[model samples]
Target chain A: MKKISILALACMLAACAHYSLAPEGAHTVQGMSFVSTTDWNKSSLRSGAKSEVWTKDGERLNQLTFIGGIKDGQTIFTSRSKELPMPEFRANMLPNELMELVVTSLKNSSGGELVIDATNLRPQRLQGSIGFRFDMSYYDSNGLARRADCIMVKKDDRLNLIIFSAAGMHYYPKEAAEVDSIFSSLQL
Target chain B: MRLLLSLLLLFASLASVAEGAQRFEPTLPPGYAPDKSTDEGGLWYQVERFEEQLQTSPHIIRNTALTEYLEELVCQLAGDYCGSIRVYLVKNPHFNASMYPNGMMHVHTGLLLRVANADELGAVLGHELAHYLRSHSIDQWRNAKKSLGIAAFIDIGLAALHEDLHGLARDVATVGLMRYNREQESEADAYGVQIIATHGYDPAASVSLWKYIEAERGADKSKDTSSIFFATHPKVENRIARLKQHIKRYGKNPKTDETDLDEFQNLVVAEYEGLMDEQIALQEYEQTAEMIDRHAAIGYPDSLIKFYRAELHRQRKKFGDERAAIDLYRKAATFERTAARSHRELGYLYIKHGLNDAAKDAFESYLEITPNADDREMINFYLETLR
Candidate 1:
């Protein structure tokens, strides 16, 4: 009986472990397809059904987040309390407004401890749709300087966003080219 | 002459009673430092390490003039302890000011934005200074250590040693451990009023500050009072009442007391736009609207306030917000001192409303005002399309 219970517990633990190593290949997630140039680990921890996270090292070192098909009136980030202000997506939002939403959401996520500066707002094309791109650099609460490259597009009254963030000292420059390739290969 | 002397004696007696009733006094001597072997010393060492990290934080406002202005004001309030205190103006959009036991003080931009004038600012600084002088943080740390036990206390020390003392660990070491009880808060409040009154500032300004905070909190539909400042400090209404009592007991000439409004405005103008930008990004529309209204009521320039009002409407985008934003933008653009970006925003609104000619004209005005605008290329693209 003890052996049987131990075996059941092992299976339960395995079921709870949802993180998996994602191979370098083309894959579709939430109606968006992208080709990964390198192997990365996928995390089950996500904000909602439309959001997913990937990491090479831990999230603090390097992270890639895909927030896809977010409908209007839905928040880009989930906060701990409903009372806390989080910017909601609106279909008619301009490029700058969209950028503000993302920036504000990131600040709210960090409880105002993250000091971020966003600059170089320009237009780009993603998945054959007109979108906007920007650069963001911030210091985490630990005083680690980090940088992110973000691209966002709106399609069929829904928003799609991709962000690749890493420590600015070494990881960002090291992964820039491969991340740019991956961003270029995205299809929504 | 006899009547005047009697009045002075009466005032002195009342002041003595007020001070005696508080039943607390400053424990730290001038140029005070803790013995390195004690628990207080350990806490100060950890905080000093955090201070080193804070110095390099990008969020710190490095403007020499602005920082010097704040430092001078703090010095005026701190008196003999001025040499020991160091002030860091952090660019956060939350109304908070924290004093570390190690004499590192953080004055958030939000607090600056909220206070009407120098007197209100002085009141807050005096309160924080009182906490430092009373050694409230060390007392609270001892209480926390006793409650949390040796195991958790060791964990805190280990976290500090590993330099992993950030986020939750940092909060535990600093804000969490320094949380004061109600009696301590009342004592601080009493001293804050008395100190400001002594410095020729109106003791009533403290009451006004708390009242404004209460009104701002009420403006939010959810009435979220879970902010770190609100959580750690006494309730706004309770603090206001206690402050009123202190003022009644201590104020020599409350009505005649003057606040340096012009000096405060002049010093803050350089950072006003950046402050507004950070506040607007928070997206707490109701509270921000209330703050802007209160700020305008305090006699800030109409042009700047109008632009932020327009920005609030433009970003929230509720029913009728577009029309409100357009009206405000037009009004703001009429003022010569308004930010040139007002025209850019008006141009975007015109484009949204399908008024291409107006959009073209607005964009041209933007270029005329700010020829070297960073987004000049983007504006030129819009103009080309309109043509």
Candidate 2:
């Protein structure tokens, strides 16, 4: 009975943490929403390096654009592919304005209550800025657990946005610093 | 002897003070100080500070060419009454136009699309003018912060007015005389009808202008701004109705001159339309979300009503959502549609999920329709590889 209960608990947890198995970078929405942090950082969004980036078993629906936003070139992904949710890219909108949207999105949202401590991992303004790394644990419907650190970089205006996210439990701890350095070093 | 001379002096001063206030131009130049008895200088200062901060903010688009063009147009329409007040043509998709304590007005491009013509635009501008001239926001700012240190209060108040106003809208409605300043808006409305009529544009155009805005609200992608605008300025229906009532009572001779809609449309014709397309297309997720909101706000049409349930389920990724969106795509593709690209999307998803056969079918269906498809090469290659 105990064993059955444990199994049942695991199942329920899995159900609550249900993530789309579509594949990383497989589904490609045309435009990508990037630069996810405001100067305000009300949600502990930009915190120290030790901060959690993403919870284990948590699915982040994200897109990687090579150059311009969703309208521009190719996207980079891991083994799985998922379409990014394309967003408005006004011709009159400057980079700074879009960046503001990225940061203040939660502040503006009515139910935006999530706050994570991700200091150095915050998105910087400079091009070829370092890739970010952090461990995050999100609450699932059934109370399951997961962690991950997603590495993101702005490559160039033409074909530049490249992102690499992985299970934060192992990969974020081992290779995040190296990934950041690699992103920082990237000229193109 | 002293009391008699003092009494005579007080009356003379009162007479002159009233005369000077009348002479005071509601539209003051950048640095003009209002004579102490008249007190318009304070508003000018507050406006200056707001303008300075607005320049650096993301909303401010410093396009000299566009500003010059707009300035020329406004001058042509209301050259005499046109104050030193300038406008910033912002690039947001939400429809709103506002003026600050000084003479700076920010007009979102979204507002330009909704207005029918130059005359309608003038009404909005005239309303903004009334706010500045009457010193509504400034007086509101002053009355709300009367308890605090005047300098510190103004500093925080100006930032709060220009920067944190939206944030405060949820919390502070009654501050700085910002609370229920409808009297000022009425004054602006009255001023505008006369100005528009004086300028040889039809004074009655204001009624048509608002009716069109209300109609377009139903068509707007995000009705958030409209809902919020009406909520704060409640019973705008009454406002428009009242204006019509005014026109009836004092109905001036109808002008034969036509308001220039052609020149107005020409300013943003092809480019604005393209931006609108991107606004709708890029916000596809929001567009899908909008359907549910539509049902709640009003009743849904039969065709789209069904998708409301299915789309929510799909977003949650239950009951084979990929299949559902594909089904939706198939149904949608049959009609005269804007999202023809959806067919290609269905194909790509099928292949990515290791369903090559399903993908092949999707690609074939897409190829049948898209003659000059941008993704033709990729689709053809995927199909060839499957073979």
Docking class of 2: incorrect
lDDT per residue (tens digit) for residues B1-387 in model 1: 999999998996676566646644578987899998998888888788777877786768776677888898899888898988999998678787878898888888889888988888989998989889899888987887788797787676555444532353335534347677776777788888878888788889899988988888899867565566677778888678767878886655444534355778767766788888888877788989999999798878899889999999999889999899999999999998774778989998898899999989998999999888766766776787688
Q: Tell me how each candidate scores on DockQ against the true complex.
A: 0.35, 0.04
Position A164, candidate 1: lDDT? 88
lDDT (10s digit) by residue, model 1, range A1-188: 99999788978644442568889999886667879888988987675668888888777788888899989999888866555568889888777788888898888887755667887666665667766778899887666789999988788989988888999989999888888888777777
Q: B1-387 in candidate 2: lDDT tens per residue? A: 999999988985674344323322354343434554543465566556656655665434566544566676555544544565677876544456776655567676656655556667777776666666656675666665666767766665555545332333322333343443555565566666655655666667778767665555444455434244565563567678766754553365454544354566455442443334323322334433443353334332323433333333333343476667667655644543323444565665566467789878877877777756644654666688777
True contacts kept of each: 0.20, 0.00
- Candidate 2 lDDT (Cα, 0 to 1): 0.47
Name the lDDT value of residue B121 in candidate 1.
92
